[model samples]
Target: MSTPNDNPVPTVRVLPETLHRAAAEVFGGAYLIGPVTDQMWERSLPMYRASLVQGIVEDDGVVGGVARSWEVELDVPGGRVPAAAVSSVGVRADRRRRGYLRALMQAQLQTTRDNGALVAVLRATEASIYSRFGYGVASTYATLKVTRRRAVLRPGAAAERRLKMITPEAAVRELPAVYERIRTARPGTVSRPSWWWAGMVDRHLHKDRPVWVLCTVDDDDQVDGFLLYTVNNRDGWDDPQQAVVEVLDLRAVDERVELALWQAAFGIDLSEHLLAHGRPLDPVLDLALVDPRAAVTTDVEDETWLRLLDVPAALSARSYGAGEPVVIGVDDQLMPDNSGRYRVSTDGVQRTDAEAELHCEVGELAAVYLGGTSFTQLAAAGRVRGSSEVLARADALFGTPRLPWSGTYY
Candidate 1:
């Protein structure tokens, strides 16, 4: 028989409900996002309980690492598929280099796959860690800073007398219905569960700093668009001009409604500048400004990192553009069942005997899967191998009318 020191083994298991708190402590401690004490966890209990967790339990019964996921649906090009919203993943501080994280991730992937999720999506705390697990930077967003003094709305930008201010409590009650109706299900977007509204929005507005909400009403008295923002007062109360208005969440049913909401924001008196985080790569603010240069993009970063759990199901779920069919070979090391050449056509995707014209690893495939990046770009970067003709065909097949964007944050 081998001794304990011969070669240690790490194992991950589907933790029962009682260990949820233990797993959450490990996750929160790893990210330094929580003191995760008994009281704090109880206050945020509903949201914590929303996810199914897999953990590495140590011999002493302290959870060492965890991978937690929520059941969500991620929109693809022209369709949506069941998705695992992977979040709160972490390894204990003392558990470094013990292979606990790897085991937890592998177990989470398999468990999520077996549970019928076709894809997994996450917002990475560290940019470099998840790629090795076949997660790719699938969608990106930019932080936009608009100079309020220089910003002017053109004629017809807003419906006169349509903007209305509402209390935070009202926002919690009403905005979820508005969001469900207005959200167009763009590729990379995920459905917001009830817990999302409660935790991400309601709890913050009620428990944290003062937040403001504005709504635009239509002739039918329906809320067509809304903006959620917070004000950062300048150094001194006398220096209101230097204050900054930060847009937290804004959604509109259409372009006109969007511009109307921004127009109202320009009317705020305390701030000379406004910053909107997680704005799409192409924001209407750039064009909505009278002087387009007044709205500047400060930085662009990855918004969603995606992993294909069931490649065939994911490939078939999204609608494709008109292009000649191409056999693309995808190699997934973590989920070997996803490795195969798939014939992609407007009709659908299917495993095929035909030799692949384009070849890429699962990470590269995930990058182009959502139609945000073109095959040609990845080919030029050497992540994709294909002839010019095949690349062009793949690009056309995956092209979307609007770029993929996920407006919500976990």
Candidate 2:
């Protein structure tokens, strides 16, 4: 067994010019890293200013690893929220299997905790990692490949809305309200922080990018929905003449607005297909595409992995679907205080007890927190055990009705 201090203590430092050079070498040089252009840095200045890039250098002054955060949008229960997204996490190839990554994660998570960040999120390149560090998958997004011939949207009670074409300039003001409405209707969404609307768009979309926005207005002339998207002519070589609309984000206040936005997307000239990155599980996209099948295709996994820093606080935050009593045994390596048997009751109450009904390691417990994974699945995989009845009960209680998803990447 090794300890945090057993290995040579790597020096952690802030971003200095020399460190940037090291970062390039660690990520791009050896890692075949995609270079971060100056423009990209200029755009990320908002998050960068608020963020701290930490690194560990070997005694010889070679950078072994680096970690940093990117500005992210939160999908609160009712609105689009903002969060400090974690990204650019990597270690030098030569340093594979070393503890550098772990050290960087600990230091970074400590910083996040100190900042009182609501949550830290990311899109994992390797799914196997991060769980050990307490991050859980909060949401999953997908790029659906639909056959336009099969799409369907029978307008719900919400009246058909009139569509309007608005530029990104107008979007800055109108899209926020639409996002607010859309997020409110969806579950597992986080609210965007104040700074996001006031600032941050400049970081994702600048004056040079060809990104465009279309707003959907209602009968009252109020902006009810909007879509930020671009075209893929280069990738459409086979269908150069066909219309392909790639959606960045589409949000509406009401079903009508949502339907209208769909219509608006289909209105794009030469667009035969629609490609969206964050379409919720049951979206109204089918209503407009020529082939509804062309609309719903790919299922994507997003959101950062979650770990229970404080089990009680984490467990009690969300409501359990099943109104049953459950005994959970948890084993924690990082914080032994979190290791124990906990009584989680219906109606979202929990307490630690001397004895528990079922026991498992902390990592397995963490997997099911936030409804990212399921206990039944864990048991099926031989990770946790109980009678079949108990397994089903735990699954019902811990499982999210719809899949649990967090859209923002930290």
What are the lDDT figures for the candidates, one per model?
A: 0.85, 0.62
Q: TM-scores of the models, in the given order?
A: 0.95, 0.79
Candidate 1 stretches greater than 4 Å from native = 1-7, 159-161, 202-208, 234-237
Question: How do the residues 103-199 of candidate 2 rate in per-residue lDDT, one tens digit apiece?
Answer: 7887776666455544556667789888787565555566755433344455462356666676666666666666666554343555554445535
Candidate 2 positional error at 346, Å: 2.7
Report the lDDT tens digits of candidate 1 across residue range 143-181.
989888898877776555477889877787788888888
Ten-residue stretch with the least lDDT total in model 1: 1-10
Give the best candidate by lDDT: 1
Backbone clashes in each candidate structure, one number apiece? 0, 54
Lowest lDDT sum, 10 consecutive residues, model 2, at: 74-83
Error of 1 at 95 (Å): 0.2
